[model samples]
Target chain A: MFSQRLSMALPYAILFAIAAWFFYLAGQFRFTPRGDNIGPDFWPRLALGAMMAICLVQGVRLVLTGRDDEPGLTEGFAAEDGAAPRSSLLLAAGVTLTLAYGALVTVLGFLIATFAFMVLFSYAGHLRAHRTIWLSSALGAGLIVILFQKVVYVSLPRGIPPFSHLTDLFLGLF
Target chain B: MDTLLQLGHGLLVCLQPFNLSMLMIGIALGMLVGVLPGLTLVMGVILVLPFTYQMDVASGIILLTAMYVAGTYGGAFTAILFGIPGEPIDVPLLWDGYKMARAGQPAEALGWTLIAAGGGGIISAIIMVALTEPLAEVALKFSSPEYFAVILFGLASVVALAQSSLANALISLCLGLVIATVGTDTTYGTSRFTFGLPILEDGIEFLVVMVGAYGVGEVLARLERGYAGAPVTQTATARTELPSWRQFAAIKWTFIRSTLLGNIIGIIPGAGATVASFVSYGVEGQVGRRKAQLGTGIPEGIVAPQSAATASVGGAMIPLFAIGIPGSGATAVILGAFMLKGIQPGPQVLLHSGELIYAIFASVFLGIFIMCVLGYFAIRPLVRILDFPEAVVSSFVMVFCFIGAFSIRSSVVDLWLMIAFGLVGYLFDRLRFPIAPLVLGVILGPLAEESFLNTMISFGNDWTVFFTRPISGTLMALTCLALVLPLLGALRHWLWPHDFEETPHSQGSP
Candidate 1:
């Protein structure tokens, strides 16, 4: 019972703490008021204050009612084909792979990073077709590179030496 | 007379080969996005934003606007034939649309959707073209105080109309406002929330926030669900059979009411097609002639929501074009696109870029026509996109999200920021905080601050000036009303629970 209540109350608690931190930081905004001009901290402080008050009220309501007052604005908008089986492990893997891709894109170039991310993420999403995964990922990555780089003229990251060479070679073909 | 002449010229511009092709491609891609359960219309529009970067501004806006227009209608096929709402806007269609299909009238249901979408969209486009100039003229008279009040009203409306707890929405909005406050202050040049990193000074782009939250965030949410909700079954006969004129005449009032309601909702900042669709259906329940038979495979049930959803695209464009305030998520991205091209949309845009404005207006009219034609002939191919594995589609979506973020400033920092926001988006979803308010806050926060600060500085820091000016005062009052009404409704619900028993088939998980 205690754990359940803690779990329910935790989101509000974290929100309150974050809002409080921002409010404090707002106080430290280094702005000297010139004439009638307000400081830069003014808007943020007002927003943060409102946030804190809202968190407090919501936290109290949660404790007293022991339930959310209403459904989320988007609560009932998911698929209606009944509940799907959830996999925490797959979610973790997806998040980890996405974050790793983001971190390594500059290091490994958009081509290599995107290709690897696509294959791994597809697998994480439960696709077991090995040939399809590799082929699609490679083709998808190649098409996107050409489309964005050559067609659209976006200067995509070319990465370090070997990967850079591969990207140039790929670019050279078209 | 002048508007007509300009519109004629605009049509000529739209008919140009390149612009025409963009419109066609945009509509087709939008339909595909709307048909695919994995891709939301806004995400699809965002994914397409980078490609528009190199195009002429007119072609670029046309592409996004065309997608926005078609997206509202494209989801109806899946919703009617398969019981899967391709977009949140189509959720309302599932009740009567799917039921009608189950009752062996899939073609009839799709017919109502096409007529409703086509009719409502064209009417709203007319209204948009007619009203935008006058609205922008009136907006030209607005000062900082009035602008601030309008922005506040928009923000408050988003919170009030939130189907969730008001407090959570408010918190989400406040968090977005805080996020917008990161980096250097525009007025004072003071670094804020930057933690001493050079990358932090330029501030977080709203595109990054949008792509991360709406794009990556959605993928993560679906991944957690293990992509469990594919369409139950496919229908062999998925073609649309448009309603006869006699059938359309019978429910003409439904079309009018829903179209007007959608345009109004679309004109209001913060509300979009989904709200317009849901609210129109609810209104139909209250006032529709066949109200009692709304969800029982009735034409009124399908027409009301589909019309309003499609019409909202035009309605949404009005505020975006006239006042420089985005009326929906998609329009906000359009606003970002306009800013990217160094073109601020407002009264000045009407004055200097009138031809471009008319070109966009023409595209809407032409795009709606093409959308209906395509919807009539291309139902089979569009529905076939569902055959692709969810895992594969999601992977491609992730790559698009990354490319979109990276190309914004070509900075790797933005990619990381996008991932971080993806997490925030997922958390918001899990926690039930609405994402719209957060996004709108980020987009409008700076405007709200600048306007408010300018008002304060202009009036010697007397904040009451906002309440003293007539227009600002009225807007402020409206903002208060928007905020309070939901609470009052909740209070009533709390006091009288049985009276507010959940409306059946009214709310769907989009």
Candidate 2:
């Protein structure tokens, strides 16, 4: 029962803490000494104050209402999951791939990084059909590269070797 | 008469091959995204935004507008045939739409949706064209104080009307405003929240926030669910079958009432198609002669929400073009598009970029026509497209998201920013915070700050100047009303909790 209550109270607590932190940050904002001047900090400070007040009220409401009320907004999606721990694991894996993809895109260039990311993402997504995975990933990456680099004229990272040469060749077609 | 002539000229612009192709492609993509669950029209617009960056402003706006128009109608196909709402806005259609399909009138249900979408869309487009010019004329007389008041009113209305708790909405909105303050202060020339990063000096790009939150974040949320919504099971197929002339005539009043309601709701900031569709459904349930028969596979049920949903598109565009305020998430992205093109939509937009404005208006009509045609012929193919695994779809969305993030400044950091926002967005989504206010905050925050500072400086720091000028005063009063009404409603709910049992809390979750 205490755990249940904690689950309900946690979201609001976090929100309140974040708001308080923002308020502290707002306080750190340097204000110019001009008389009657609302400095650059005015809007952020005002917004942070309002957020803190709202977060306080929300937290108070959760404590008073207890667990009988509908769960806090963040709680519903968790209950809907079939296996929460597994879902979290999957999400973690997805995020890791995403981060790795972001970090590696410039080094591995657009082509190799995207293809590898696509395959890993598909495999993570549990798509078992190897052909579908490779084909769709290839098509998606090719189309994106062409659309962005060729048509849209945005420069993509060219990587360190053969991949860079291919990216150059792709760009040359335009 | 002058409007007619200008509309004709706008028609000429839209007829250019490139513009026409963009419109068609936008419609096809819109329909595809609309039928797929977990993909929203706003996400569709955001994902497509990177491509638009390379095009002339006209083709880009035209493409996105076409998608916006078609998107409202595309979700209906899934709702009516599959009993699954492709998006939140399509939720209302499942009541009667699915019932009609299960009753073996799938074709008829689809036809009603098409008719309602087409008729209501055309009517709203006509009204949008007629209203925007006059509204802009009235707005042309306004100055900084009035602009600040109106923008404040916009922000307030969005926060107050959010289907979630007003507190959550405010928190989300304040978060956006704070994020908007991260760059060098244009007025004071000092950075407040940059924390000394060179990238922070330029400010966070609204597109990064938009694409990350709506696109990557949405994919992450769906991933958390393991893409666990009910799978599409039924494979029964039929062509769209139109009702008889008498049958169509029977539902004329439903169409008219829903269209008007949709337009009005659409024009209100923060109230977009989902609200319009649900409210139209509710109003129809309460009114009309056949109201008692609404939920049991009735034509009125299908007509009312579908028409209003499509009509809301026109309603959303009015504020966007007239006052440069985005009335919905999709319009907010379009606002980003306009700004990217170096066009600030307002009264001045109509004065200086009349051709582009009218061209967009013209595209709306043409889009509605093309959507109906494509929707008729492409239903079978779209259903096949939906059969693609959810994992694959999420993967595809992630790819586009990465590309979109990278294309922005070709900065690897933007990609990280997008992924970070995606996680934040996913958390926010789970937390039931309305993301719209956050996105709008990022877009409108700078403008609001600029306008407020300008007013303060011009008026010698007198705060009352906002309430002194007649137009600004009236707008300020309205903003107060907008904020107070919801608080009063919340107060009532708190005071009379027993009376509010089973009260449906609308989620502006998208």
Candidate 3:
């Protein structure tokens, strides 16, 4: 029942902070001088103000409607985590592997990093069957190689400097 | 007919060897993502976006459009077999479809669904082809005021009409508005939510928010029950086949009615497919003989929702091609594709680019035709994906999410942003917050903010400008009416006793 009021209110709390921050930031820009007398600051400040108003209204609505007696704040996140620790662990591993891949891709090159990422991430997630791992990794690498190299023409970095010469030569052979 | 001649040109563009192959690849892949639990059509299209980068705009568009049309229909598969809906819009489809499956008529139920879905798709295409040009011509006349009014209408329907307890929905709507307010206020270079982080300068990525709220949120929802519990049983049998001609003949009117209904509703900005699917089901249920009994695993229950869901595509495209507003989420990604090509999708899209519009018409219709052919034969092979193991696929999704975010700008910030959003989404789900409205906020935020800002600017910050413009004023009244009427009805129900007949009519749970 995430659809209930208080749960919705927490995110709004995040929004209120974001709006105040935006208003603070809006103070920094030089807005355009349109043909009309409307200054550049006009629109951004208005949006910020409206956002603030919407936030205030929503916060009041949540407070007015919150359950009169708070339920014992059950450790809901813990319950969900306890139920699916294995899947959650796999998800975390997947997240970690993806971040590592992102950090490594430019350094190692898209092909090497993506290939390693797909294989590792897939295996870490429980796709350990040999055919499954090889096939999916091949699919991932093929997507990068074909889609980027041929179709989109994105100039993905070759691996680190010394190895790049070989990578360029490899790409050229294709 | 000149229209017939134009179809061949579109076919030439769409049916090019590479494009045709891409279309096939897209449909197949689209179906996989569409049906799989956890992944979404938005993600399906987002993953397809990077592939579109270097192609001619036409081919690029068809590849994505093929996915849009197919993925919209593809969601029905899981809805039918497993009670778990792939997308929230498909939630309504599950009511009758899964019920029909358990009733031992899964074959006929699925068959009727296919016919209705295909029929709705075809009709929507016909409508799009015929009307996009005329609609765009009208859209060309729109000014900032009109755009503002339109966004206002869209925002109202989503935030105000989203759920029961108007107060709750509006609160969610406000949250979206706030997130949208983050990042650099475009008018000024001021950083709002950047939090001293460079990524904050861009504010929150809608993709991050979407994946967080839906993708990660869904994972948390699934995790809640524990994987140790029994998996929902599949109602499919190896012997299931197409419906008999007699059975199909009986629901001819239902098919036609749903197609028209879907197209009409799909045009309303922010009203979206989920609303259309549920509305069609309710109408058919009330009017169709099986209304009371339909969800008991029958053909009508399956056909009505399936067709209605598919029909939303055609319906949604009305605004997309006409005024450049996407009626639903999947099309919003398609709208992103349009923006990428430097093409403004509103009225001029149909006028200056009539052939392209016609070709897209022929292309989408042909794509749907191919979907029917494939859905008929391809499902068996598709179903086999289950045996492949889930971890591998979700992991690939995990990586793809990062790549998709990064490819937008080749920035690492987006990758981390996606992860952060995923965490936010996971927490949101655990906390019981609705995610779509937040997205609707993010997507609509800029539009609404810009429009309201411009309206105020034009009137020199006069609050009355919003209420003073005739078109704007009426809509404002309507917005007030929309917000107030529901609360009034809710209050009346609380204040006075009434028979079911005396109570106000409800649009039903979204």
Candidate 4:
């Protein structure tokens, strides 16, 4: 029960702190307000102030009641399926893979980075079929390259040196 | 006669081979997106936005709108056959649909869904055509204060209709507004939240926030559960067995009431198909002639939510096209599509681009007919989409998300921003904070702020001017009521829990 209360209160508490910090920043805007005009800080400050107040009220209510007033939309639906065994490690790996894919797309170019990400992500997702994984990743990456780069004209990043040269070579065939 | 003639011309435009082809592709893709568990209708629309960049505005709008129309019905197959709702709007279907399917009437259940979607969609399309012009005429009279009030009402309706904690919804909305306030202030040319990043000055694109939250964020959430609850066996064969004329005549009122109710809810900004379905089902429970028989494999139970859900598409388009405010999330994406194409949809759109407006209306009509036909004949293949591996599907979703983000400005920074927001979205989901308010906040925040500022400037900073103006005052009152009534209901439920029976709308409705 105590842990549940803590979980409920934690998000509100964190939001309150963040809202308070942003509120302070809102006051330190670099420009002064012109005559009769509301400053740029006004709208943001108003939003932040409301957020802080709601967080405080929610935090206090959670502490007193030890239960949320109601389940949120996501919470309600998520409960409908019942609790399944969750893998925090899998989630962490997924997040890492996604972030790495984002960071590497510009570095390794779209084709190589995307293909690698797809294979790794599918493996991380527990797809054990090696042939299926490799084949799908290659075909998927190639099709997307042609569609976005050649047909749609997105000008995807080609990366540096070897990767760029490889992408160019592949595109030359297309 | 004039409206009919205009509609005829619009039909002509839609019947053109290119436009017709786009519509067919859009409908097919929309059904696929809706059938998949990981791909949402709105995200599907968002993924298609980049592709629309190269097309003419008319074809672009047609494609997106067709997707919007078909997406509402595509999920019913999964809901009935597998007892898995492809979208939140399909949850109501599961109560009777899955039950009926289990009771050895799967094809009958599907047939009910088809009639409800087709009938409700067409009726609401007619209403949307009739109502949009007068509504636009009224909207043309609105000023900055009124616009701000309307937007406030939209934001408030979203929070009120949120199926969870109101406080969390409000906080999510506020956070979205704050995100919108990032970068240089549009009015004063002063930098607000850019910190020192050059990319921040141009402002965070709402599209990036949307793709990250809805697309990447959903994938992460599913990944955390190891993609649990994959439907293992296809128990029922995919086919629709249409109800007899006598059966339809018996539930004609259910059809009318649900379609009308859905259309009305759809016109209210921020309330979409999910809300319509839940609320209509709830209402049917209270007032339907066979209310006691609901959830017992009854046709009325299936029709109420399905009809309302489909009707909402037409209902949602009215505000998006007529008032420049999106009535639902999908319409918000459609609004974004318009803005991306250098078109601002509002009253003036009717005057200057009347043909385009009519074409959209005609497309909705034709799209509904085509969607129902597809739903009838193509159930087997659409359901087969569920057989694909979750990992492969999720990986492609991530790639589409990345490409979407990167293509926006061809900048790596936007990709990082999208990834960051994806994390935020996953966090929001785990914490039970609804993502709709956040996305809507980002989409509608600038309009809210700009209108508020413009109103202040026009009225010499007299904040009361918002209340003093007649229409703005009335809308402000409605906004307050929209915000307050939910809190009051919650309070009553808390203070006296037994008095308030658990309505369908109050449980997992969003």
Give the 10-residue window scoring lowest on summed lDDT in candidate 4 chain B.
B501-510
Q: Each candidate: how many clashes?
A: 6, 0, 9, 1
Candidate 2 lDDT over residue span B109-187, tens digit each: 9999989999999999999999999999999998999999989989998987775677878888988998888888887
lDDT of model 2, residue B54: 80
Chain B TM-score against the true chain B, candidate 2: 0.98
Q: What TM-score does chain A reach in every model? A: 0.91, 0.80, 0.69, 0.91
TM-score of each: 0.96, 0.94, 0.82, 0.96
Query: Looking at candidate 1, what is the lDDT of residue B73?
Result: 91
DockQ of 3: 0.22
lDDT of each: 0.88, 0.84, 0.66, 0.89
DockQ of each: 0.68, 0.43, 0.22, 0.65
Location of the lowest summed lDDT over 10 successive residues in candidate 2 chain B: B501-510
Predict model 3's lDDT versus the native.
0.66
Off by over 4 Å in 4: A1-6, A72-76, B234-236, B497-510
Q: Compared with the true structure, what per-residue lDDT tens digits does model 2 show for residues A1-174?
A: 656666766887887788788678767866565667677878888887888787777777767765223322223223433333338867887888988988888888988898888888878876788998899888888887887776678888899786788778876776
Please list the residue runs of candidate 2 whose C-alpha ends up more than 4 Å from where it truly belongs after superposition. Answer: A1-7, A28-35, A67-86, A162-166, A169-174, B233-236, B502-510
Put down candidate 3 lDDT per residue, B242-277, tens digits, no spaces.
777887888777777777777887876666666677
Query: Candidates ranked by DockQ, best first?
Result: 1, 4, 2, 3
Worst 10 residues of 3 chain B by lDDT: B501-510
